[model samples]
Target: MIGFSCYLSEPADEQQTAYLKQMQQAGFTGVFTSLQLPEDDPKTLRQRLNHLITSCHQLGLAVVADISLASLKRLGIAPRDCSGIEALQLDGVRIDDGIDMTTVAALSHTMGVALNASTLSAETIDQLANAKANLRHIEAWHNFYPRPETGLDPCWFQQKNHWLHTLGFKTMAFIPGDAQQRGPLFAGLPTLEPHRGLLPLAAYLDLKRLATDHVYIGDPQLSPRSIAAFQAYTSDQVLLIQTQTADDRLYHLTWHNRPDVAQQVVRLAEARLEHIFAAPEPHHTDERPRGSITLDNTRYGRYAGELQITRCDLPADPKVNVIGHVAPVALPLLDHVGPHQALRFKQ
Candidate 1:
């Protein structure tokens, strides 16, 4: 499942509500908010939280709030008694370190509960099981690191996710958004350090490969370009590649990787079909770097007009014309294009 953050630190206004709707239309089905801000006025926090939850409910988005004992007290709801919580129409509550297992287990029966993925231990899992927690409503959620170097190591994260799967627990992680990053430390919230600067989709794909069941945008918003890319991906199963420059003949058409695949580059299957495009005379035989969009020149015989996206750096070849390059921020996506995957270029 894909989700995005909608913090309550600011007022829940029409703008924020509209963003929720935009995100829902873009294929996001969940909203994560935090009610643990101690600095905010309690009354104001309650009002904002209520408004946010109402908007989510109306939009048919699942809403989960990160809660602490103080925040719960501010809302005048006792943790053990879930009646108040149910009335608020929350889909779930993320329990922090201080919350006891009995409470966590009890909350699971009433609503969804997310436990800290990083600190969860075998003993704690045993305790939750012994307490008869509703396993179906419980998931492990990794915290997003606001500090640059504190994010979880990718290898450790993958291993931990594997362990969680063995124990029948769904897992979630965060990736930073491209716009309106959260304040105090704007360095991006990510579960893996390397993901801190990646585009939202690239980081999300990485997390999926790492065995995460759900991915959330840690920051407040995504740039328009990122949103469009995600929309294309979710709605059409097409990988959108932003290029510095592209030949309109190739860029305008959706190309698919050859069924047989290639080790060093993405081979466009239709590029070599007869009458697809005019055989190009070699003009720009620039060195083929990774992410370069290249077309086979007339000197390559029947292979002329064949198009390929380089997967690794290659020396300049007279038979190939380097046409364009994938945007640097999007280079990470080159490694993920699978056999027969559809690719569309955006200049």
Candidate 2:
């Protein structure tokens, strides 16, 4: 599942509705919002939220609200806040800075609850389990840090995600949006610190390797190019590659070769690039063209009938066979591929 951040406190109008529809077309299924902005009037906030939620539901988008004990008090709602939750038709509520374990356990039973992944621990899980919390209604959502240089590390995230998954909890993470920089600092809304400059689509794809259940655009806005990329990606119509430099051949090969979907990604087979398949011969024309995909031409040679994509520019050897070179865009991806990762050709 994927979602985007919504910062508006007022009800929906034509513009907001159109923007949300656009998001849905771009593969977003839901939205996450916070209601604790200092500027909002508590008296009328519920009406605004009612309109927002009702409108979102009409468009088939689920809404998740971020709330705290203080915020609820300000809204004059009870700790359980069933009326507030019901009125907004909220799909879930992230317990911002989460309350006590007792409240956490209580909320999990009646409605959906999202807890901070950073604060979730073995002790917290045990306490919740002891209280008989409904695990199905609980989700571990990573926090989107507003501060610069405070994003969580990849290794730490992987470790935490692995721990949560072991306990049967779904996990969600936020990725910074590349387009439409937010006001004030104009930085991305990111759960991880190092992802500020990464394209939103690429950020989501990279997190696929980590197996996050949901990826959200942390920023309140998105760019048309990013939205188009998501639209093409979800439909599997095209695989949009994000690269800092231009690589025409790589782009052409990927564009024409098509892409195959795996558990968490789509891959193009380098083996499919072989123009002519031939058995290796005893002739030692083992020219190892670095960074080239090649097939052996020699008969009865050790590497006969094999297509190998070179990772570097090794000296050309008599025995090495050269077929094609990866485009600049594809070069960076090669280093990150795992041996067991599935690679398939679409067309």
Candidate 3:
């Protein structure tokens, strides 16, 4: 199943609501909310935090809250803050700094949430594993600023692949800039042969196929032609999509004529990939909740609900509300349109 990260903006009540609504409309099930603790009183901060969680749950979104190690360090917080995990009932916590394994393990147990450590080294991985950190995943940050020369280095690529496999960690890689710039790297991989057909369907399909299950494609000025090409080529595969925005900007990198573009893209993808004939329509068990429909088809399930939409079938949503905003029309088409364009309407 595909997932999204809501890190382009900051957290707020209104932003959270809008983010959740957009995720549901887009058929996204998981969200990674970036956490930036407020400087208010701890009690007030707790209230705000609780409100954020409640808001996400109401929207049926799985919550993966991020706690930047760098931010924590800047605030002079201790590694033992991981023990304070019980305060926030998150599904997962992202330790976004290079921290020791023992600290990570302690935090994981204290919080009872999976750990996502970002951009670490092989030495770091071994140390974490030795310290018994129950890391759910690891993401390499190298791709954020991909240098063509560095990316094309066979020795570097081989070493990175070996390290990832050796660490036994699920990996996620981001592709910087346009898909065309990254297509060669994507096409160069052998494991991606099966997904070559889906290549022309989406921008950077080859990279997505070769990298981990999670792929980030960021280019503010991605053209509609490129987007159309991507959609046409990768109709068969499940892919997570997100609009890119910078902290200083109020709009997304990819400008659109309407807000529903993102939603439309998500809807079309869901309609195309969702198994129409899987099981009996999913019964509305308590687990399913109200205003939500879970459809089982293909290898994954399609969760459609007023509060959230998820393909992974996880019980929670992980989207975070960022401070930035994009034009309502700036969203991908999947957020606005339904299967076969039958449900095309404003959200």
Which numbered prediction scores highest in lDDT against the true structure? 1
Residues 270-340 of candidate 3 have per-residue lDDT tens digits of 32243322233323332321112223322233333211222222342222112122222223323323333
Assess every candidate by TM-score: 0.97, 0.73, 0.45
Residue ranges of candidate 2 with Cα displaced over 4 Å = 9-11, 242-347
> What is the C-alpha local distance difference test score of candidate 2?
0.69
- Kindly report which residue pairs in candidate 1 clash with one another: none
Tell me the tens digit of each residue's lDDT in model 1 across 80-99: 66677666678988887456
- Candidate topping TM-score: 1
Evaluate residue 115 in candidate 1 and report its C-alpha lDDT on the 0 to 100 scale.
93
On a 0 to 100 scale, what is the lDDT of residue 310 in model 2? Answer: 56
Can you rank all candidates by lDDT, best first? 1, 2, 3
The TM-score measured for candidate 2 stands at 0.73
Which scores higher on TM-score, 1 or 3? 1
Ten consecutive residues with minimal summed lDDT in candidate 1?
A: 79-88
lDDT per residue as tens, model 2, 1-347: 89998765545578777878899977789898887766788767777777777778888888998988777877777776556655557888898753577777777776789998888888888899998888899999999876789888988898889999998999999998766656668878788776776767667776777878999888877887678767877766454544322223343443322243232222234434553344645343445433355555554364465555555656656665554555443443444444333322111
In model 3, what is the error at residue 42, expressed in angstroms?
7.9
